[model samples]
Target: MTEDRKKGNSSKWRPQTMMVRGGLTRSEHGETSEALFLNSGFVYDSPEEQSARMAGDKPGYIYSRYANPTVRMFEERLAQIEGAEDCRATASGMAAIHTMLVAPIKPGDRIIAQRQLFSSCLWILKNLMPKMGVEVTWLDGSDLGQWEDATRKPCRFALIETPSNPLLDAVDIRAVADLVHNAGGELIVDNVFASPILQRPIELGADWVVYSTTKHMDGQGRTLGGAILGKTSKIVDELQQYYRHTGPSMSPFNAWVVLKGLETMDLRVRRMSDNARVIADRLATNPKIKAVRYPGRSDHPHHNTHASQMPEGGGSMLAFSLKGGGDAAFAMLNRLGLIDISNNLGDAKSLITHPATTTHRTLTEHERAAIGLDDTWVRLSVGLEDPEDVAEDVEQALAGR
Candidate 1:
């Protein structure tokens, strides 16, 4: 470790402090901000140095596809905040998910996953994994009994997304982790919805944690990035080979952008959660709304589990079903003059999406119904806007119903 790393590790700085200063390595110039090394290749002092680096005898970046200084800085900073031994940054959220799922397992391995997940993730499990000769079993994430029953037969891995996409369903991470462990399987938690500011899955018994840094980390909706955090052995030893060869590496520029965004992640996530809570509460009272789901709210189906696992807040996302179904949902979205219609979440600007038609469109009607995602459901990603103003905009949109 360098002197800067030693200092950062020795000091017991809090999350906010670490976000600003953790894993920061200065160039010889001593610049105030993290330097972006945009070069695709690095120069070596001699052929001996290049041979040593290639042979793993020396420590230096050989190629951008394998590693880069700016990307390393972002990875280290994220690992510090996440309390992980190491981390790897990816090109996008889906890339991170694909890497985590495909790296450790082989043909005939069994993987269990929560049925309620982002459509892309669902496709990987239900469609892609099988082609690779991997068997997948989908179960209700909120049900501890189902998780236990499913894990009775040992599986290679298990995956789940807490505060599930569009629906905001919370899963019991600790219990599920314990079950998966006893079954001799690793647990991977997709924590994009919860954000690192509110949830740390590694501390809750998850063997690995994944995030779409594109979301809350880059709260400005600027860059697309993803991260995987776990033991150094798992990341550097096991996953690095696949990552290096497959080339899903994050760009140096995107890494730098996300590094800057991490500085304000803690503040922005909390503010957005606060705004989401206000909007969810207001929407619950509207007669045109049939149902509302926000983990921060006490009435949520798994509110107790959410409280125990995610004590920080409900997160910046929420979902509700309109009484009039798809047409009314589109009408309400069209009527909104403030909130933009978008499929992306965790932005500085509030975004709303109709999941049945957009994010989860690939699923058949029966599959959609099985997950309780109907035409009326609308997913909202609350932003850093004033809570009252966001509430008013949502309320006025409902008036059009």
Candidate 2:
């Protein structure tokens, strides 16, 4: 282990400073940028040294599947910014979610989650967990009564994503964390929407926090990555074994790319969030739009909760419903010239997607309707583009409708 990792000096610095210089360790050659240790394995000075490392008597890299210097730098930098004691990087956001849920659970354990989740997450809880003999329960995330009632019985774990996907519904993290803990369950918060720059779930009492670093962390629609953050014991002891054996490891190159991306994440997220607020406000007034959902907006159903938890900004995402349903939604999307029609979000370019068709297409109409996803609803991931330009493009599209 490097002294830099041990000391974690970045923790004392502010978030922007940490992103730029945190977890920085230089090789003997003293490179300015973080070195990418691309090799699959490392060498030991002697067989005795290798034995000690394998036996846990000494700390050093063994295999890329387990750890690498470049990946560790990324993990440490993110952990510092998140205020987590430790962090582990994975191949993708889904991989991080899978590891966090699967590592500390066993067959027949009970898991409770909010119903409004990303499509892949819904699949895992609804389909995969049951096949693994894990009991899963779903509830409306914004309803505290539902959370309190369901957690009355003991459970192994509980998970929720605040400002939920597509809808931007907010949940009380502190309240949920208390309920889950009282029921002998650990709380795992998916903080992708409210990035570390916006919200820190650990400070709100969540036991574990996970992110698809592919989103705001990369902030450029480049390289895929995910991360899990929590106490050192939980990661090094409970989750590390499963992570190593399953080989859902992040590539050194991707880690390095994201490490560089972190340097500008704070600036990009703030600017993008400002742009989203401007666009969402404009959408709210348009007669053609039925509703606009932005956590920063006062009319949002959970605006108070969002204000309390993420006062920094409402986040760079917004969703609105058009009066014309799917056809009108598609027409507006086709008419927009400046924004790209891509499902991917948190990019430098504004992108939009129809949740009912693109992201949640697999779900039955009944299932989609239950979560407030309709053909007319469109989710927009505001990017670091000029707010006026994005608004102009949207206005022209809506004018045609």
Candidate 3:
């Protein structure tokens, strides 16, 4: 480990310690694993106690929609892992994104966001926000100048996704946060790519951090969930109203699954990131590969920034373009036997997807091209497989193509 990494707060204990024991809450039984509460609402022992709980005079869960022990355990554990003052779990990542964005801005407000995003996220910003009377401006996310320019205008919110989907683009979270703060706006970072294991946007000065727990947190394809973390004031007082009333709360069973997923997340992410580094290096030397983008690799545009921001490594995700285009990509995908042809990331098994037709299909051809998602672009989510096998499978697939 680097000297800086060896001496930080997290340096004292390895990531595994943080992942397993960071936010454990045991009941009187002292169970080894986090408990699951499946009930929709908690019953009171007495009418007076129930009234007091309802009036916020006592501290206990009144309804599952508002809170549950399992959901609270997941939230608390994630908050501790993220080093945030508060957190709330949503039914899915998009639900977390929607609640965070829609809850804060009023009609006639303005939001500045990065242009490259998940297709669903792009639709939320470009299509949904305008309809709600919130004007939005799209800027090249990596361009600090464009961020400054956009923030200088009257903006209430800013949305960014570091190591963006499909393209693996990155933005300086601290610099952008500074600019957003100077212009009187809150910066929300979608940290799904880096996962909490690789990046902590709140420590970088972002006002809020969101995650698609469906990805790395689960480290498997078993469940779908999302979370938002920030200071206690906005999370409890402001964001809670929108989250609870919208009824997008995470199910207790899903929360229990995610809770278990967290125990080994750090290990899974580390191994996956290592695999990504190896694959990225091998892919870069291939003649059929047009370009490769992995934050861990030095060839990436923001390698230095990613190095400073992500202490563990770039992450388990990377994207590359083929020399022969979309047809070539399909041929390679068809021949691949080890890696699954799926868009989901942060799984125990390797997966691949073509962004042009799958994730970014919502965009027009011109818009998709503008974001560097060409027909040949293939996104790979490295898993806990042997690096040699992964590399050989990719090479064999490309050869058949």
Candidate 4:
């Protein structure tokens, strides 16, 4: 079955079927769902076999850190969906990003990244990587010219996120991939905001993709996990050593949860994205809204690029700011009886957060201004709720007594 799948000869099976049944390795019990293996290490039948496995002369799981049956199923299933040859699950999303960047580059390496990213991700580039003697540069991702200009000097890596967090802004993946590749750099995309259901960065020319499975993949917010997917050689050869030694492995239980989450991810993401589109439209026409940004809208800065990149409607996240100010925004958040105030996204429950105060709060006020995160700005993660209820909550919240 694995051989057939790798060759793309699976008889045109739909994505939903692949999600449910792909990468199954049943034991003697013949379980319908994938079974969990909770042991720290696998035993070899003979001492010689163990030695061969240790020397990379055999094929099988050795230690949980390097590989586990449960984690392998999740990684293979994710790789299948993303159309990548290999994948590795990490302890968290930042670990995946850090491992991928740090494994390949040495001292004096340079990385060019988009200015807008999750605050922790920004810290990795601006603060963490620089401490290791790597040079990091930030550019406006929406402008292809800026990307081109930045890469002209040659860099080791280029990273970006599309329909970026909090802002819902976009960077053209394929175009930037070309720019990075022409300069001999690897392109890595953080595809957390647009889950695999809504986007496939690999097909669009990304050399690798990363996900915070804790977000949309788990869908219910049950567990914390992350994954890195890319070409097989990169994973097994380059990243495998770094991953095994550093020990940021995903737990078997979390992998099992991620596998189950994959089954319903498509349905949840579609409905939530639809609700988000409706909410974005309704809020755009209101008198209290200074600006509304949803990639699904025709007026969005990158509507044309989005049309070419994402044929589906804009994803399940959007951001808006009140014309009145932070006080008004707080009143709206306070009035919310339906949407929960939280930092997490892509949960079963609708969530909203003031990025300036919560997610991006660590950045200075001037830095927040640079990224369009103001006290008045609120990022909404639309969930599997009736569109009317979500919109009504926003409507009432905007009106102050």
- What's every prediction's RMSD, in angstroms? 1.5, 1.9, 4.5, 2.0
Q: 2 or 3, which is superior by lDDT? A: 2
> What tens digits encode model 4's per-residue C-alpha lDDT throughout 1-401?
46554333253567877777667677777677789999898889999999999998999889999889999889878888888888999988888888988888888888999888888988888777878899988888898989989989888889898879889888999999999999889999999988998889999999999999999999898999999999998787778889999998999999999988998888999898899999999999999999888989998777887777878868889999899889888889998989999999999889999998898988898888887778888899999989899999999888753
Which segments of model 3 are wrong by more than 4 Å? Answer: 1-15
Better of 2 and 4 by TM-score: 2
Candidate 3 positional error at 297, Å:
1.2
Query: Relative to the true structure, how large is the alpha-carbon lDDT of every model?
Result: 0.91, 0.90, 0.88, 0.87
Q: Higher lDDT: candidate 1 or 4?
A: 1
Higher-TM-score candidate among 3 and 4? 4
Off-target runs (Cα >4 Å) in candidate 4 are 1-12
Q: Per-residue CA lDDT of candidate 3, range 1-401, in tens?
A: 45433222243455566566555556777677777889998889999999999999999999998899888878877887888888999999999999999887799988888888888999898889989999998989999989878887777889999889978888999999999888888999999999888998998999999999999998889999999999999887778788878888899999999988998888899899999999999999988899999998888988888899997798999999999999999998999989999989989999999989898888998898778778899999999999889989999999984
Query: How many pairs of residues collide in each model?
Result: 0, 0, 0, 0
User: Across residues 1-401, which tens digit of lDDT does each residue of candidate 2 receive?
Assistant: 65655444544577788988888877888787788888889999999999999888999988899899999999988888889999999999999999998887889899999988888988889888998899998899999999999999999989899889989999999999999999999999999988998988999999999989899988888899999999998888789999999998999989999999888999999999999999999889999999999999999999999999999899999999999888999999999999999888888899999999888887899888888888999999999889989988988998994
Error at 153, model 1, angstroms: 0.9
Cα error of candidate 2 at position 23, Å: 1.0
Best by TM-score: 1
Can you write out model 1's per-residue Cα lDDT over 146-237, one digit (the tens) per residue? 99899999899999999899798888999999999999999999999998888889999999999998999989998999999999988877
- Scored by Cα lDDT, where does model 1 land? 0.91
Residue 26 in candidate 4 has what lDDT? 74
